[model samples]
Target: RALNVILVLQCERRRFLRVGLAVPLLGTVAELREMVAREGHIPPEQVMGGMGGTGKGRDPLRATEVPSAVPQVILAEVSPQGFLRSLGDSEELGAAGEGAPLYAFQPPPARRPGTANPSPLAGNRGLHSLDWLGGQGLPASPGAAQPEAQHPLPSAARSSDCLHRGASSRVLLLLCNTVSDGHRLTRFGPPLVLREERGISWEQLQQSILGQLRALLRAEARAQGMGVPLFRIRLAEGMEPCTYLSPQDPHPLCHPAIDRALQLSGSGGPPHVRLMAEWDLNTKERLFGSVQGEAVEDAESVGLQQQAHRQQPSCTLDECFQLYTKEEQVRGTAG
Candidate 1:
């Protein structure tokens, strides 16, 4: 199933360009941002707005008032009551519900000193066919032009978790394998995006990890006649030795140990992908032990395992279990 997304592209001086998109019902906010960037001709790398659009009190009209070295594009949700809410890239689009309106705010091209400001709405040169919506717009800044919009804003405003304020933590997960050659580490897929707002507990995190592993093998299992995947997380923070996660401890995300590690990592950025997840020995024997051994025979012969200590081990998806961390199940409509 798919839904139509009505996106209003907002620029300074009352210029509005509206575009429509047919997106999968299950498409994510990150995917929607990319689609908007592609359709609206936004520079992907320059599209570095925070999770929620510019918060209240910031003037969209003033975005272009100051000279900026680089341009930025921001995506935000407009409520029925005409309030703006920030959207997370990893969130599901359908969470916004039916007939929900979206707005993309981009500043116009930078102007050199002493150049006359061009009228963005004159003759509707930059405005596309508009689905004009009326409500009290953001309070107009002094001397800001008022919009000529006529459509009435929807009466009922629906609440969605997607509009909440929080940043998702992305953690990189790696698998550890020990052979006669020694320790070999490899990353399977993209970094896991933790969306829990209240802080994640150890048990919840473990289930999420195992669930992702099962999803990766489910397709192959059905075709090749295999069993469910099995593995346990053995977490090790940045540059530290590995240790198994225990059920005894809860609220791992809030642990002081993790906080100290994040402080001392010295990267001053998102923590490194140092968390290790060990595959159960019995699982290797039952699932892909022989297949991996055969697939990497040449690498083994060439001492690749020794090199894997420094880099990712060479292997194919078919030769190893892959993990894909995805969003939680969402049920709603998008329009």
Candidate 2:
């Protein structure tokens, strides 16, 4: 549950050079600005913008972008990948892009139990192909029925839940490349369905997603190979990102939104692995259908993950059972 806010400082936009920073995402707006100023040596006045890609403006950061006296830097909240993709080259930053990732304010997480620091998950195995993620996309057939996506139900128990209707949920995987600056590439993979007929497996979904994602974000993604790329699954009104961390480590402290998501997913509601990937598709033909990398085999399925999650001490999913309905709460209060 590593929680961090990624910000791209568009210093001198004309030069197309930005310094990306990863800060703790939990602080308040004023606190964050103060923190950034103290740490980055830039006063809060220099930090001007606060934006979230979430359409409805439900983003936590958007609420804090109140008008102020200083030249507030437009501090936009983007994924680490997006921020990295925003940074173009080492020559641009004058430093080797330590893993081509955004620089983080938090110390890196500890590696899996036995591994040394700086080791990539599963031996840093890169995903081999993008074919399974919808077959390089079929030529548009005139009458082909476009896939339907299912909106997720709330975490609370409800008689009208989507799962009760016996329909599978679909999600759009989005991958975006901002390094091109003027000519950015944003690709959407075929919709992935969350089906109940087959046993659910978050592990499999995650691998399939990472396979396609790594495919798009390869070292060769950029002809210049310097910009960072990112992908996420777009839900109805928000974007969910695929989480990366050490294999042996427990999930980074889940964010409140994610904690809610876990509860909803484990509650027999619609569950999806966010698979939004941003990459340059124009020159990715070489990667299309090319399956040649190692993939981790998972014996446990998503159903298993849910069950194990339920068994954990003080798991939020289990805590859902403790919640009382409004009527029940009223009656208890009256009694």
Candidate 3:
């Protein structure tokens, strides 16, 4: 019976291990001995009693039947604290150890706001201003048609001496503005206008502008120099709404004029230039709605009061002369 109990407990321990559960050690041994004594194979008192038997010389069979000593097995020597410490050390060593350079293993540091790397164009400052004389043509004017002429516009010229200059030295000026109609203000993209006071021919200006534009757009580094002053105006809003100009989809403020200018310049040929201006009318209110009729009436009353003050007459030159003559006579007698 005792053997049967030991076998049952061993089976339970094996089953626990298989199912990933912890096994109890000393309790299992005690239960096995109790079962053996209950079966009448051995006396319960002898098994239950402490390891030493009664002083009287008991029968050898009874003594041998119940084992005097249980062997001890060392399952594991590690404490919970020691095991945790070992695991932590291994992880720390992997992170900052000599196996890999710390800088190489770590992620790069973030850049500060507005501290981005400088542009390549920083070196090409003077190239922006070099003038190239290309052609003689009619001066640009607003709302005028181009006159028919036989000679084609001249191409830009280049010199061997000025190849190393940067864009800053060449850039004349940059201007930016927004277009709005009282109610709504809309942004417009930058329009770059480059000018050269002297030295470069018209052909050179065209070539330089084209070359610079290609660089700006990140196109091929070199191409035939277009011989004209180039003007690029990008609309703050994209091209779609402005090109269509539908009332259902209102055009962005600056887009209309910018789009028109680009179209005209492409078709009209070289020496392209355009002027942009804003027009305003006091009668037009914000797009949402107009002021009420009563409000307009009140405004008119206030305006009349302002007009009356403006029209009122003042003392004339004759009155001032008479006053001055009386003062002069009194002063002469006193002297």
lDDT of candidate 1 over 1-335, digit per residue (tens): 23333333333223335555556678776666666667666653323333323532346555422222122344544332221234555667787434345555442233324654333223212111111211111111244222112112222122122222211232222223322213543333222222222134333454444333332333333233211213334434433444444333333443344444444422211232224444544454443343331011121212432343447558777555554444488888987
Cand. 1 Cα-lDDT: 0.37
Please list the residue runs of candidate 3 whose C-alpha ends up more than 4 Å from where it truly belongs after superposition: 1-152, 163-315, 318-335
Q: How large is the C-alpha RMSD of every model relative to the true structure?
A: 28.1, 23.2, 45.5
The model with the greater TM-score, 1 or 3, is 1
| Better candidate number, 1 or 2, judged by lDDT | 1
Q: lDDT for each of the candidates?
A: 0.37, 0.29, 0.25
Residue 53, candidate 1: C-alpha displacement in angstroms = 18
The TM-score, computed over Cα atoms with residue i paired to residue i, of candidate 1 is 0.29
TM-score of 2: 0.20
Worst 10 residues of 1 by lDDT: 127-136
The model with the greatest TM-score is 1
Model 3 lDDT tens row, 8-41 = 0111111101001111333342332233233223
- Runs of candidate 1 with Cα error greater than 4 angstroms are 1-198, 218-232, 237-243, 264-273, 285-335
Please identify model 2 stretches exceeding 4 Å from their true place: 1-185, 193-206, 210-255, 262-275, 280-286, 289-335
The candidates, ranked best first by TM-score, are: 1, 2, 3
